[model samples]
Target chain A: MNKRELFAQIQEKKSFLCVGLDPVMENIPKHLLKYEDPILEFNKQLIDATKDLCVAYKPNTAFYESMGWKGWRTLTETWKYIPENIFTIADAKRGDIGNTSAMYAETFFNREKSEMGFDAVTVAPYMGEDSVGPFLNYKDKWVILLALTSNSGHKDFQVLETGGQKLYETVINTSSGWATADQLMYVVGATRAEEFKQVRKLAPDHFLLVPGVGAQGGSLADVCEYGLNDSCGLLVNSSRGIIYAGKGEDFAERAREEALKLQQEMEQILLSAELI
Target chain B: MNKRELFAQIQEKKSFLCVGLDPVMENIPKHLLKYEDPILEFNKQLIDATKDLCVAYKPNTAFYESMGWKGWRTLTETWKYIPENIFTIADAKRGDIGNTSAMYAETFFNREKSEMGFDAVTVAPYMGEDSVGPFLNYKDKWVILLALTSNSGHKDFQVLETGGQKLYETVINTSSGWATADQLMYVVGATRAEEFKQVRKLAPDHFLLVPGVGAQGGSLADVCEYGLNDSCGLLVNSSRGIIYAGKGEDFAERAREEALKLQQEMEQILLSAELI
Candidate 1:
């Protein structure tokens, strides 16, 4: 899905929240495990409960990956459960040399021929041009490259200066030449709200996948104030804070409630900023 | 799969080579496609042919992830096929916030209860302390964090100055506090041969997962000159150059030949350095 359609979905649903599907077998309700595929069962219910209230559904690949074959089957099935209107992200932090990345592009973007049919993916640009360029080769698929992350180690390297600019800023500027704003996006962690102002200046039109909001103590107001673009171009993800809101049978219900709260606030922010 | 055992395997094999399992469907021999799982079949043959030649097997997770459910299945099955003595790596570059990263730690390192049993994993430390610390929490499992990448873009930020120190240096120095040399490793690209000398000073005893050896034109002699340590802690990876060596019915055999060439070179390096 393109940025315009993603924005429209947010406005129509009155939400900019992207609920993260970082499922843990232990954390999942015990009753749900009775199903043939417990993870898929849990994800289907989560999507059904919060689909209307959110603009995106991000399934972190590592969670499914930990489960091996069963986990992967559940991940694919869960991808089918989400509505077409809602943007789907294969939170697979994949980045490699160009020739290899081309196949990764074909794997996720080309559904009819390939297995992973996600609309977008999270990429690590540590490998440079060839690694990231292959993901951008897809026509409509989005490349959410890592910029300034939301973790404490982000201070280790991302903030370092390169030719008078921070490493993250340099990545933004250098990679901007490879793909346009339409196909490219940056993962600017919500916890680093202050850096978003500088990030916005580098790629003004590109979207930003903001994580670490509800659970990580990154204020929604702080992120919106500094990161939101001319379009409602921020996909704020909240995994533990929303999905595990309640561990009982009412888990999905409580998740929807938390997602609803975020969406309602996002609607106001969009309106106040004259983005919608 | 602790450091001591992994080192023993390298000594017994008389080889420090880590065969890269990056199976691309299009590149595989057509005869294998008739099987239920072509990738798995190709990998089984490749593993069978080279099991005695190499001490470790590193599977780039992106290749399996692109294949979806089947790809993930192939990866798990392939892991099972490898001999117990050989070190296994799930080359999934993962890093996120603290709480979320804790889940990643559980995903990769918790094998007693988890389906994906890997000896080590490649992690991105751009998120700082919290992101990297969780991965280090798992005892006996190695965390191969990104330090200096080999791609063309490595110049963009990895070598940048932060507070008068190179970004990679800062990562190597600071990350020492998170994990011991036994559990922590850094990805020092083979292309950055000269930089390996400096990297050794910061991380004298830690292993280095070196990529870009063959197809990327990184010299083996150059890498060994500056990168080797007392334990021969170097997992040199060659993806396309080995797996897609010939792309014909003899692909597996060709992969063995490519791997043998590297194993021979590593043997010489180890002998000269008196590591074995």
Candidate 2:
């Protein structure tokens, strides 16, 4: 999806929320195990319950990959199930050299080859431009480059003072040249709310896929205050808080309740910010 | 494999050559298309031909993942086919948060879970300590961190001066504290030959998985000159230069011939250093 189409979806849905489909078998409801593929069933219900409340669905590939080929098949099926109007992101932090990265691009963006074409794929920026360039080759696809991550390890190297600027700043600054905001987005963790202000200055027009709102203790208000742009350029992702909200037979309804709450809050924010 | 076992393999084979199995279906010999799974056949033949010459096999996951579930199955089968004595590396440059990284660790390290138990998996260092910590939880499994890459984009952010040290240097120094050299390795591209001296200062004992040796224009002699240590702590990888040596029915033989040439060079280097 292009920036305009994504912004349109956010405006139409009244929420910039991106529900994370990181379903672990151990965490899914016990009753759902009766299904042939419990994870796929869980994911389908979650998508069904929350599709109207969110503008995108971000699936962290590790959750599926850990389960082997069966899990990969589930991931492909889940991607196919997501509504076309709502954006999809393969939160697979992949990056390599030019040619190798091209294969990764084909994996996430070429539907004919990979059986699933996500609108965007989160990429690690450590490998630099060439590693990120191949993803940008696909005309409408997005490359959500990791900038300021939410993990405690974020301080280990990202915050280091590099050439009078922090490493994350250098990443945002240097990587801006690789692609425009239309095709590029940054993964700026919501846990680092204060850094959002600094990041907004560097990437005034680019979208930021913000993870760490509920389960990770990041405040939605704080993220919106600093991270939001005229186009509502922030995709706040909530995984455990919504999908695993309840484990009963009414799990999907409970997930909708959780998503509805976030959507309501996002609606208020969007209204106040005049983004809708 | 453990550090001692890896070094023993290197000494026994008299080579530290690592053959990169990055097979593109379009690039493989036309005759191989007769096989039920041509990519798997190609990988098997490549592994068979170079198994004796090289001590390690590094398959960049993108090459297989691009083909979807079938490709993933090929990767699993290929992993099962490799000789147990030789070290296997899932050159999947993966890293995420603590919990997410645990899933990634399971995907590559836990054979029971992912069906592909690799001795080492290359990880991107941008996410910090927690992102890399989970992989170290597995016994005898290695986390080969990306320190300095071979691509032209490496100059973008990796070389940025951070607190008087380059970003890659900071990655090596900070991450060295996360795990012991026995479990941790760094990827120092052969293209940056001069940087080998600087890298060695920070990580003298840690093995460096050096790519860009041949196809990327990195000289093997230059890499070995400043990069090699007492245990010959280097795994020089060659993908296109060796695997795609010939496109005809005799491709496997040609690949062996190419691998033999590199093995011969590595053997001479080991002999001259008196490390064999």
Chain A TM-score for predicted structure 2: 0.99
Q: In model 1, which runs have C-alpha deviations exceeding 4 angstroms?
A: B245-252
Report the lDDT tens digits of candidate 1 across residue range B1-276: 888887888888878788889887877899988999999999999889888988788998768767767776777788888888888887777877676677677666666545666788888767778877777767688889888988876775667777778878888898898889899999988988988999999998999999889888899899989888888888888877888887788887898899889889888889999987
Off by over 4 Å in 2: none
**Weakest lDDT window of 10 consecutive positions for candidate 1 chain A:** A107-116
Clashes of each: 7, 0
Top-lDDT candidate index = 2
TM-score (0 to 1) of chain B for each candidate: 0.96, 0.99
Cα lDDT of model 1 overall? 0.83
